[model samples]
Target chain A: MTQATRVHVAVPNAPYDVHVGEGVLQGIAAATAGADRVAVVSDREVCALHGDLRRHGVDAPMLEFDGGESIKTLGVLEEVLDFCAASSLSRSSILVAYGGGTVGDLTGMAASLFKRGLRVIQVPTTLLAQVDASVGGKTAINLAAGKNLAGTFHQPHAVFCDTGLLGTLSEAEYQSGLGEVIKTALIEGEPALAQLESISRDLGARAVTALSDTVARCVTTKARVVVSDPEERGARRSLNLGHTFAHAIEHAAGYGRVPHGIAVAVGLQLAASASERVYASSTDLGERIGRLLSAFGLPADLEELRSRYSLGAALTANALIEGLGHDKKGRVGAPEFVLMRGPGDIELGVMIAEEELRDLLA
Target chain B: MTQATRVHVAVPNAPYDVHVGEGVLQGIAAATAGADRVAVVSDREVCALHGDLRRHGVDAPMLEFDGGESIKTLGVLEEVLDFCAASSLSRSSILVAYGGGTVGDLTGMAASLFKRGLRVIQVPTTLLAQVDASVGGKTAINLAAGKNLAGTFHQPHAVFCDTGLLGTLSEAEYQSGLGEVIKTALIEGEPALAQLESISRDLGARAVTALSDTVARCVTTKARVVVSDPEERGARRSLNLGHTFAHAIEHAAGYGRVPHGIAVAVGLQLAASASERVYASSTDLGERIGRLLSAFGLPADLEELRSRYSLGAALTANALIEGLGHDKKGRVGAPEFVLMRGPGDIELGVMIAEEELRDLLA
Candidate 1:
């Protein structure tokens, strides 16, 4: 029997399996064996790269649209639904999203709302998707108001990621993958992060292995958190460590201008700095994290470059405040931010003073 | 102290709370208290009857659309999303569905997809919705091919049923409510079903008290099963007792033409008759059920209606076959209809032959 690495993501109802390996795309047919019809929702980039998956025994109709982070909007979802209706796809059918984070988020959501709900499988082509977006089942899209402003915690039936596809990504895209890998490392611990760092020298062989392993590791950490609090009411709030700051940067920079991982890279650094300044987390460790982010060719000084953003500080503050307000963690009142004391240690409902936050504004 | 009755529905992750009483519309404000914005997905009927819920201290932006079962299609959902976007509603916004089953189903689905998943509250108007549709976590809409073909099992945060609304329904609509009531009676057995027969004379009074009580009792039964299998893989199959035949009939006749409850009444009688014929169930009980359904002015015979339905044997056969295939109970193979031996005693996986099904077709 072939060795198939299985990553079980603990969602609310059941543990969903994520399979990552060589030629895993071929396994899409088997992963959704029971579904009578399969509608593959892919962007133009993925379709062009994969050479028309409908030709490859996918055995279902294909719905292709313009590919990009910008496509992950409610408008795109409407288009996808129209496609499903025009194709006569029913709830019994399965939807396979064949692309990166944006595609995964948008397609997962489209499949979710098609008939109220349906089964979806993620065929993540990007390294960022394989490690992060595809595993947790947080399907969503960006609106004009904010990034990931619309989404659901819908776990896919299965995720099939072929690491061979990573070879096709540009160096900038590959570095973006490392950004998430580092985020997982900082939160998860030194061991996984260190292992990924050591392999970064060789982008071809060792980097792919490191990326795949890190994806698995991040997924494991996320699955454990999700299983405990699938709705993010309690302990799962830690997963949003850098996301608050990240959302601010993404919105300020304008959507699609800031790649998610790059923005997250900056956000993670800011979070580390905040932990040090506000909560007395290890400043040295924060600097070490800063070094790793910069070493990975990501934006390490976003807090310092606050003036570069087009949006106002008050606007950024409100947007982040509004985003946090919508979060499931803010069940009580005036959504609280999670601050860290150190690695593996967190304080929930930590009120960050507006004066202190303003002082830290570069 | 206010005598606030909060019913806990046992669903996976977070079991929902159901509130029943007068001025429950006011309770909706409390449920969505902390939301940044509120989006109400209602139809014309509920808005007209409730007199623009916005007037009742619902300051949130409302998305009003066409009412009825037909509007539960994909096209309507797209329109709803467009409405949400145009209104500048963000992911943190609260979505409240105000109406009967169709409204609840469509809104629940819209919430599930909008921003991946948004918080949803159900304010059911009709009798069928208050007791049955709103209480259970099942949310779905009909497709061109089948009934409830596209959907999800999303439980709302809370449900409010104002018994006063049932006052406006026509006599035909009132009889339609009995269809589900009778179904619950059959599933719950002697105590629940016998209690039902007692209140048969004073249905109007009992509907406000005992009818809601019976529906809640049925909800309790299904809730227990749902807790074990939120995804509807195991014991949850029992709830689909009369649904298979009901779905077929509803699709055969135009959806709104034959009310859901009317189809269910006919379907339940047919199921009983089929059980007696195929699985050695009680012929006496089956006849009694037919009598009860007929007394309520439900359609017990389909011979005269056959020509009008345009239901070919092949269509019926495929519809039944495909419908069963979608049933979570039929995981191992072809879905078998649940045949009852008596009032409460149910037999699982009774594969009825097509010849026998054709023989019992009336």
Candidate 2:
């Protein structure tokens, strides 16, 4: 694979760079030039794959642990921070999130805590992370009571998406990634949705290209929203399209049990259905969304599917509806949901009465 | 007892406010805008004093532990984060860091990690914290290898410096705080330094006016630096006038044995000595700096300080001589030390060779 491509993410007050492509690990030294040290945070899996990258003169010590969203607890973040501290990673050190979303989230947080916010670079190895988690500048860990209850919206100086890392993912994991790709495409515009629908068959070479294009497109969309509303103060709420339901699914499943993209895919279906029921969207459009998910082997029947998964009754439909009340958009005294009327058409759905929510779930 | 007597700090980004007064605990709810869920990270001592603050508002589950710099570990940060997650603190919820620097450091960090950075308000109840730690937006926990090796520069939305809390502090802790006040005064200007020096004698009723003025001046000095260079990029380096040697002293004495401010006092004395030795200034100025520290009962001897402080032999001498080598002024391929030629007069000290460092230290 070619050397990882480097790209700088310009955050108004804090400017950082993102290194892409492959063999980017070798460039870590140069990437972290101004940094006095580097603290490489990763889990067992990614460390096994690219652990050697620490020697590239990054000036940071490589710290690894068993990785999983389930383990994305405050405990793990603290451990990673201790490792960074033990390594003498100063404020000038580059904290590299060297795994998937879980690693990225925790590492980013560790950087934020070291000296009250140090230079951090995201090295996202998962397609889900590259497309969604790594782009938004949000870093967090899960708690027993909920998913992502603790986190910060500190953006990274750079994000490195080495597509070559896809070589290691299981098919299930790769497919899990497609869920976000599809979500992004639908959120983009009519062109993206039509393009996705047209390539239902043979998502092999065409699939990779489509997915990559969709990720870039989604990145641009999320970036615009983030730039405009870095703290989710206003327009950024639009990016939560299906996250409301997804958070519930992830929380109900107790994190890690449901891959983020899979949960997001389920969330999309719920949003589609909720749109039909609450916003009076075309019912046919909701059914079409199910078909598209089914075509991609994604779970469309979220209720029935919950039984097959590790779903917590407390966190599922009931908790999700309640949690939406806590979202920033809920400030208007209602959970304004993001809905899809049709392919590439999304609008904010008004909050349904609690009584109506129970009926819709039923 | 008047509400206006409270010490308040406002950070612009979150439009953050920190209130430090006799009954600031009652203000926590008001500061947080009545968020239903609250995550409070504090050590045993702080929790005891304001544990009831949790009951003042909603059902706020308090997370308490030992209060000290060493406890500002990743383990503590994680535990607090776990509490936030377990409690289902939403984006709308607020986190209160209820303690001194360590508590503020970890609490701010945990807040930053929760939901990718939550709205956090710091309630600093120590003189050291009130005038310095509570204002500049620096937060972190110490690692086994050194002090604040892993952390972030996440600013608190608000800071509370409850001067009433000072009534609970021991004389040693109170004097330690003076070290910071002195540092701030020296950097602020001649008027501030003189005022601070006068209050250093009797921090009682007669000196209350001087103390308040000193605190305000110090806070403004830090606030101004943060505003111009919040991330310690350029002008902020001025704030680290005594930190190079202070860090070494803290490291050498171990973390908790010697308070941060006390070590900073020693560091200040050393910095003055370095200034006289390196810049050819008269040793009389260094003696004056030493006498000023002694007036507040702060240690001026470099080797006699107590704290779990350790240093990479090179760092002990190099970091001070090099001004930590991370400041923006150090870009000339040489360490630029921020040194004072005389009281109220500061200049960038050029990088000296390692061989020359031993002579200066001697």
Per-residue alpha-carbon lDDT of model 1 for B273-359, expressed as tens digits? 888888664567766776676666666655423443454453354454544444433423444677788777776667888778776
Which DockQ value does candidate 2 get?
0.37
lDDT scores in order: 0.68, 0.67
Best by DockQ: 2
Off by over 4 Å in 2: A1-10, A14-67, A82-95, A204-208, A307-336, A343-350, B1-12, B15-66, B85-88, B204-207, B303-337, B348-362
| Chain A TM-scores in order | 0.88, 0.87
- Per-residue lDDT of model 2, residues A1-362, tens digit only: 44333444555877665555545556566777777666677767876775545555554567776767756676676677667646655556678887888888888866766556677888787777877788767877666555666667678877767666666776657667767777777677678777767775544233444444445555666566677777776666666777776775665555577777887887777777777877664667556667777877777767645765736464555766665554433532456678776665677645667776666554
DockQ for the candidates, in order: 0.25, 0.37
The backbone clash count of each candidate, in order, is 9, 58
The alpha-carbon lDDT assigned to residue A102 of candidate 1 equals 82
lDDT of 2: 0.67
